[model samples]
Target: MRQQIDGAVVLTAADEDVMEYLPNRGVFMAQLLGRDRGNAFGFYRGTMGPGCEISRELHTETTETIYILAGQALGIVGDREVPLGPGQMMHVETNVHHGLRNTGAGPLEFLVIGHPDF
Candidate 1:
């Protein structure tokens, strides 16, 4: 099913059902847009439980951007470790090793966008 607004697709919580868990990462993602939606990039909502982390990895051809929605996070982007909070955004270039650790007492929520489909 699809939800649209002014001819544009809108993905809401109710429109998501499939949550993909990253192996051993304690991270879950719900894809909102990608090839299936005829989009050139992938859009997703991700959640990480407190004290959880996502291991460093790189997408050879994908540029990624993540915006924090709630809680705190430590982002490992390439050779730097950056602290992130709600309303903050991080951009990672293609082939850069990047990861995230939930540093808040509560769940860490964020939106992720990857170009060329993630």
Candidate 2:
């Protein structure tokens, strides 16, 4: 069934479907369920506060394309670092190490889309 959603509504997917995660480094407060658009892909929404960072990590199982919805972030992908702000998108393949950080002085809203039925 096709339904409409407002930013305020809650959604679920994985068993612990809640999207917000409070990490010691930053705030990940908003999460949106990725409605499958066919294939083995899904989406995840995350909100981070200023200085919030996604620790350096690699993906060996699932690949994802992350898009910045608001604010700005610094991404460390491989041996390079790049800055991305609202409306920017980056594609990351599996097995590559990459992470994101909210370098801006405000909260960052972004989405990370992944694939495969995990």
Candidate 3:
């Protein structure tokens, strides 16, 4: 699963890819790029059902950049809560506690990019 065109790699919805869904977590994620592509950073597309949440946690070695694609989100960084929506983005530094909750009525879709291939 990868596509190479003119020395560039491209992965689209049309590509047959594997997506991981955790019912208990109410999350579905697709790794678009990472070790499988020999990339140093990881790129993923994730979705969470309404009312679902990812508990606060810290990544000691990985920095994460999240970009919302659709729906709304309530992002918790450290002790602060920030509201997010489509086209908005959030950056979480390494070792910082952060989490996200789907605050919209529908599914929350977003992109997550992490360094060091996490």
Candidate 4:
């Protein structure tokens, strides 16, 4: 039997699933593309309010990339902290530790893509 496939051609941010990632940090994430939809990767948009941050973490099997859309933040890739702002991109190798903290006055918005899904 042939396998059935269900997916959308366009994913609207407004219709995506949003999750509050941290407590009292004003960090929110919206899954724009998901693995359950038969995708080879996971894509999400994260919004971090000023002073918000994601603690250091590593992905054992997935490589991740973050593209800054608006505002600025400090990105931790591996053991170093790098400044990131609008139009900047950061790549995290597999099993590397990474995180981000919003340091700008406005909300930080960015797109995150992970290989092999999350």
TM-score top scorer: 1
Prediction RMSDs, each to the true structure = 2.0, 5.8, 2.2, 4.5
- List model 4 lDDT by residue over 3-98, tens digit each: 334534555676677899865368899876668763777888999899989888899989999999999999998789999999999999898889
lDDT score for candidate 3 against the true structure: 0.85
Question: Candidate 2: where is the Cα deviation over 4 Å?
Answer: 1-17, 20-24, 29-31, 34-40
Using lDDT as the measure, name the better of candidate 2 and candidate 4.
Answer: 4
How large an RMSD does model 1 have?
Answer: 2.0
lDDT of 1 by residue, 1-118 (tens): 5666675876575468657465736788888888777467788889999999888989998999999999999999988999999999999999899989899999999998989887
Instruction: For residues 1-114, write the lDDT of model 2, one tens digit per residue.
Output: 233465333335333344445443665533333334335556666778898788877778878788998999998899899999999998889899988889998899887887
Q: Which of the two, 1 or 2, has more TM-score?
A: 1
Off by over 4 Å in 3: 14-18, 21-24
Candidate 2: C-alpha lDDT? 0.72
Tell how far residue 55 is off in model 3, in angstroms: 1.5
Better lDDT candidate (1, 4): 1
Give me the displacement of residue 50 in model 1, in angstroms.
0.5
Please give the distance, in angstroms, between residue 96's alpha carbon in candidate 4 and its true position after superposition: 0.9
- What is the lDDT of every predicted structure here? 0.86, 0.72, 0.85, 0.85
Give the Å error, residue 84, model 4. Answer: 0.5
Tens digits of per-residue lDDT, candidate 3, 15-117, equal 5464655433787787877876746788888888899887887899899999999999999999999999999999999999999899999999999898977
